[model samples]
Target: MYNNKFYVVQDGEFVNPNTNHLFSNGLDPKDFIVNQDGERYNFVGFIFNSEKILISFPKHSFSSTDLEKLPQNSVMLNKYIRILFNCIKRTVNNRNDKYVGIRNELNSDYPFIDFLEVYKYYKRYGLFTNEKEIKKFGYAGRISWKDTMNKSPKIINNHNLLFLPLIIKENIEQHVFISKCMAYVIDSTLERFSLFLEGEKTNLHTRDIDFSNTSLVITQLKKVKRTLFKNIHQHLVDSLISFFEQEKTKGGNYQLKIYSFHLIWESMIKEYLRTKFYGLNDRLEIEWSDSARNNHFEKKVAYPDMRGMNGFSIEPDYYLILNNKRYIFDAKYYQKLTKLDYKQVAYYFLLKHFETNRDVNGNIINELETYNALILPTEYEIYSEVHFELNPEYNVNESKFVIMAYYLNTLKVMEHYTNAN
Candidate 1:
């Protein structure tokens, strides 16, 4: 119960304990999950249950800077896991308003941690204010007749009543108890995030708040008496109820749930472009937006109504406006840009086909001048912009194939993503 497990594996590497099904809940976990290109991919995330395991599945590349290594818990391990977790949450919550709830599909479009959205909303718009009777002094409800003679004070006007000791009908102790209960849940989560930190750890949080028990947090929940008002309170009540119910049925003991870490890798790359690369004009200002942004980008390329090609659309990970030129960057999680990636080439042509402006006399903006690259993660530990031209021998003036592959250091991206957000 005390062991803070840690693990650090590349996208497709094999591990010792075989974490395909570490916990009995969720899906029957599998090692070597068939990933991009039908190859097995390792998924990683910090387990938020009783065991406190910190698993990290960085994509394609990671550094040996004494960090990463998700299976064994350590200060370094906690940090990498946190960075990945935060990245996923930010990436999801940025587009979603937290109230949108979790999306369910055969394959999740993005990483989703269970109840993270609800936790976000409840924490933001806390418990509802109670309806109560207010009194002038110490919440003494309803002025009494005996007080008129006993005190013999001037109580002629409403002003006099206002000056008396203020009191409330609802029990103050009950509210304080409830607030503490919610705080216990939040604070404990923060503390557990650092449970495995060794000598290299800092004070994540004291978690000083205490509550009677989890049941009180549930039982003490105030019920709304009216319909047409299933606001945040109602949503939270149902969510928390479902949470505890699933905790028992799923048998995860409220462990930290996570989707594939590649989702994080995609986010990390996007964050790097947004945060680290200064003066980098984000062509897509709504870049952090979730699937909707993907749709938005596709909308820009209006389909030609059953023309030569239809149906599928191009949604580049990033179509940045950097250094006064358009660049299409695809953040691929694979270790290397496999042999033939027609997708990037299609992305280039799709935009050119639809480019009304930013083009030369109805042509695709001088295809040679238009830039495109596959931004992949690398194990290199420094800030690098290593670019590899897909067709190195091709002449840009004639072939106009400005295709390239760029290797960005994973540690660099992680550090920047952690700090920028």
Candidate 2:
């Protein structure tokens, strides 16, 4: 907890949909305790003030009713005394060393190198190195450099609970710069970067983005995007391994080895929204059945990566619902989509099209809405590798075959809709 505020991670039942009230009784997420030997573990703490009882989990709740009872930093161990502002500020400021190590691991011309270039770009473009004479920021010298980063904006005056570190302006601006860079990674070379958004379709439906989700993904993407992005670079290097291919590389081919997964996934989702879902781009309108009797509006369908006790799962890398027709797709990262990949896609088709169903109270429903499977390849395939199994049990091969062409093809389709408007 920083400044008597706590970092709360809410996890439990008793979620109120109407009130948006998460259980008020749960513990804060970041509370930790130190052992006799100075080892730290989970120690939840909360501070109370007035009517608000900042209740944290396990132990430690503070009440402003007893303002004098709060623990001070002097009593707390240094390791356990993490002020959220100081920690994240330290992380961002000292990221150069971590990035240097990352760059050392990859070869030249790697798309990730370009990705890292964004950090440098932001520092330059955002004028982050230069200090401004702001009230909350350390430019006035009242607060420490680390504390300055956690400075909250003046307008968002909700200081009841612990606010995010740094001023809202700096935090958002910095994150937006990073988010734009991530978008560039998708737009530039590879047309995709592996990104895990918080929820499927929620942000898409709204005109504005949820900055919190973007912030979370940016931090996580730095860890995983490095490996996946390098795969694209490695493929380009290996593809030119043939002797004849070497002759065309005299001027040096720009090896854009960016994992196609990110771009392809982005394209598939965006296209599905534009072409199929139309204006309803925000929420995932999926129909699922996981009950004794299949029904459309029955049992609560699991979201996104839905897994069940029976080992039956619905993993839709890109889920498309047009009118009432369902198109389930799983993206494959490959230099070429082979017959084996087709079989894999065919399997998913069977899982989505045939086996998966909706359940009503005690019966099945929605036999009219057709479900189709799509094996969305990362890039263009020279020849159609699609094939159907002769199995009568799951007629997967009967579904239409679509190569998905390129990322632009989807964009083009979307543009057509926009232009028509």
Candidate 3:
């Protein structure tokens, strides 16, 4: 099993239970497997039936020459990742108190590359390290007879209690810790990149980073007191540390998987919208569901089998409240939305309308106009918006809810929304 998930190599391609089902359904494997160019591929990474597969896209999967042939949507994945990284950075910068133990699993075939981009941005400013006072027994510095007596008593007797100076130097504890972190990231990236290029005969030249030197520095830096590093260096160190901590907790190869990407995409959209809408209007409030329980709303059960049971609960991705109206939004990172996806949002809209406050004279008062929307990442050259209105003529009530599709690229959709608002 790879990362505790079973997979088999079939026809030189990795097939997990999920992807296997895709193949069984007669869909092309290439449609689901995305490469760096955003092109669909039949295979990615090394084709091996190993239990511990490398967590990265293979370097040989795409070439610079194939850029023009790539699908238009191929760039959307990278754009989304970039936006997600920026959103997280913004969160770290502003409201740092809320950043404690914040973890998001990255789901992308080229997660390391995405992370490398973020790492490079921070590295450009240089790694954060602090000056630490370190004392060491050396032949030439301040003398310490106590330390000398503790060690080499015979030498002291022969030299009339003479002792070497205690060496003192400013140590970069934070830098060393950061170097150690970077070394791990670099080594893992190289290992996964190697897996992707495993049988190719071409002499591919991979970009090199001095991970060894960083690691050596880490070893030397360990001699100093660790607590000396202050929170001043947290901006750079915390960002990278949180990423590594996330990967380690997930217990998978270094690559970001698609399942995790769904969460990341949802978070990116919420954060992006939050930032964009900030200070624009006081009436607009963006709220997130911290957990399923917190977001849950009870609905009366009528089925015989479910008798005596509590009401069912529904949790939408987010609620965009403008004045008294609530706009329900569900973020789906899939290439296409399914019927169940539509029904789920519809249920939430209906539930909200039904459970809302009623007028004192036995009428529904202030029937908050509701709209349900499916937010999706689109690869279109131009943005598109589609609305499916529920006709009241066919239905029995004046209450209406329009389920709309918001096709947007996170990297460029802000301008469209801003102008419309």
Q: For this target, which candidate reaches the highest TM-score against the unseen true structure?
A: 1
Q: Is candidate 1 or candidate 2 better by lDDT?
A: 1
Better of 1 and 2 by TM-score: 1
Please report the candidate that would top lDDT against the real structure. Answer: 1
Candidate 2 minimal-lDDT segment of 10 residues: 193-202
lDDT of 1 at 317: 74
> Which lDDT tens digits does candidate 3 get at residues 156-259?
66558543444333344544555545445555554544422212121222234343454444343443324435543444444454344334323232332222
Q: In model 1, what lDDT does residue 38 have?
A: 66
Candidate with the larger TM-score of 1 and 3: 1
Task: Report the C-alpha displacement of residue 185, candidate 3, in angstroms.
Answer: 6.9
Q: Residue 136's C-alpha lDDT in candidate 3? A: 69
lDDT of each: 0.48, 0.31, 0.42
lDDT for each residue of candidate 1 in 1-421, tens digit (9 for 90 to 100): 3464444545465443555455434223453465555645355444444453435456644544443433444555556655665555555555544213323320132112334534465456653344444323344555544443444344547454432333323333223333343444444444444443211212223245323344644555543223316566566555544443333322324433344455566667766665544422233221322222221111123353455355655567776543345667777777555566787777776665454344445544433235666767777733323243345465443354556666777766766676763
lDDT ranking, high to low: 1, 3, 2
lDDT per residue for candidate 2 within 1-421, as digits (tens), equals 1333322321111222321233223322232323344422232222333222232221111122222332333343222223311222222233445334323322223333343343333334432221234344223224444544355443345655443443312322233232433333323322221111011111212224333354453454454344434554333223212111221221212221111123323333333333333221212222222221311221112323344455554444554444555544444322223354453354344444343346765344653243323333221221122233234445664444332322222223322323321
Model 1 CA deviation exceeding 4 Å by range: 1-10, 17-29, 34-41, 47-54, 61-73, 96-131, 134-184, 187-232, 249-257, 278-312, 321-324, 356-368, 382-397
